[model samples]
Target: MRQVIQLRTEQLGATARTTLSARSALAWALIELQRHEEAVAQLRGLLPLVLAAWGEHHEAANGVRLHLGTAHFASGRPARAEELTRVVLAVYPVMDGLRLRAWTLLASALSCLGRHREAADEYTALLNAASPVYGEDDRQLLWVRTDRLHQLAFLAEHDLVEQESRALLAGLADDDPLRAAISGAHAFVLNSAGHHAPAETIVRAALAHHDGADLCLGLARSLNGQGRHEEALRILTDARTRCRQSGDTEHVSLLHTLTARALLGLERLDDAETQARQAVEAARTHHGPTHHRSLEAATTLASVLAARGRHTDAREHLTHCAAAWRRQFGPHHPRTIATDAELAAVPKA
Candidate 1:
């Protein structure tokens, strides 16, 4: 199934430059590669052509619009993305696919804008729509469902709903290993939400069940979130080494970012800077400059530069990151907002 999806996505990319099919293909390829900027660019370029050929209300236009909205959200332009998604949903009320895609994008955009309540509503709608179409037993469907649940958990704002969502994820462990890894992600989210002890327990359980690099990275993130910087560093370092051995450059870049964060937390400034720089280089080469993973690497490098008192260099990197993120996601996304915050935090001499 995964391979089929990959092949379909790749075919879209192979045809992107000269045809509308190419735009669709490029969008799919870029999204899979985590290259939101490039994905958004392809979608934006293709959208008008699609709309012109098939009118704004046509199904094909609506379909491409749905994807364009996602590209916007990924690139950090939530408001624009939201606007496009809204138009699609409004025009194609019977399109379950558009409904699902639009709501997801809406939730993401709202989250980026810090509108938690709206985001939660959108997620709830998404879950409701997905449950009927995908069913409970389908793994791909469950993955999307669980992702919505995770977002709801984050937007809950209170522990009651958050804990409820966590419990739900934990219960899925036996039924779904992928979901179990996602449950691990939920734990990291919990830690971010300030519920450390429960997060730790959930992550530990997840680590025991899944030995994948992503799961390990999630565990390390949870640990770091709990202030166990050394443990996080060690885990990330090991993960990086393993990814390198496995030729998983994407995972290696991810681990490097995590390691850099841990090092930063430990006040190992020099080492943090080195790792951050390395991560940027690796991400650009392996994941490409427009990928979310590469942007993360760039963000980490900028943070490290700021920490090392190279404010100018840090600003430059942040500026580049901001521009790139805007191009990919639309400038209003949470990731982009966070990047802006990081830039703002840099000390000016």
Candidate 2:
């Protein structure tokens, strides 16, 4: 396909080039190959040609923009991806699969930016819009629901996530891959809500089927919450090794955060502080300062500081963190309430 595009590039007219360019297909192939920068560059070059040949609102041009959005996302530029996807959605609303892809991409970008509430709402809207077209039980809708549940989990909507997880799990076949995701999400909510034993059980069951970083994180959190530091560290170490081997940097901050908690439980204050700081820096660099994970990492760092008798510093940290969580997740959210409580509990200097 690349060779064909190259061969026809100089010979074809604008209209012929639009058909021969196969911009979407080439961009997807490059993205799949993990050549993100190359894909982005190629797509940028193709967009003007597509627009000139097919006009701005034409389906082909919109498809090119959508692919460009995906490429931007793949390249770790979710903000740029969000902008492109919003444009595509504006001009190309109600197209069959294109609209669904645009909505999904937009929601995912928002989630990556730590706009969990907005992302969950977007996913809800997408599900509503797609249900009549794709049916309620469609696999795509199920996946979308799974993503929304994840966003809700980030917001610490424990009850809703748990309820949705069970319903989604019951609807899936035993062998469905989504079962692992649903189970992992449920365990995450359980762990967040302090049901360590139940969370451990659910995560273990899910791990029996799929060995993933998320499952490992959930299992480790369960163990950590139960005060089993050694076991949690072991699980985290294995997960970290797998992540390093696969070059999966997305979950590294999470691993560090959970490891810090386990180390803190073991009274390794220095190690805990080191890990916590790393988690905060990494999460902030990757997800931006206000992202859910970044704020969680900051909260973890504050706990380490408090444990080390740095009450003044801890109070300052929680002061900023609590306000951010309150503004982003609402004052009633578990995270916001917990941050506020932690702040109040800090002793005066």
What would the TM-scores of all predictions be?
A: 0.57, 0.92
Q: What is candidate 1's TM-score against the reference?
A: 0.57
Which number leads on lDDT? 2
Tell me the RMSD of model 1 versus the true structure. Answer: 9.9
After superposition on all C-alphas, the RMSD of every candidate to the true structure, in Å, is 9.9, 3.8
Candidate 2 lDDT over residue span 82-169, tens digit each? 9999998888866488889989999999988989889999999999889999998988899999999999988888879978988898
Off by over 4 Å in 2: 1-15, 18-20
**lDDT, residue 106, model 2:** 97
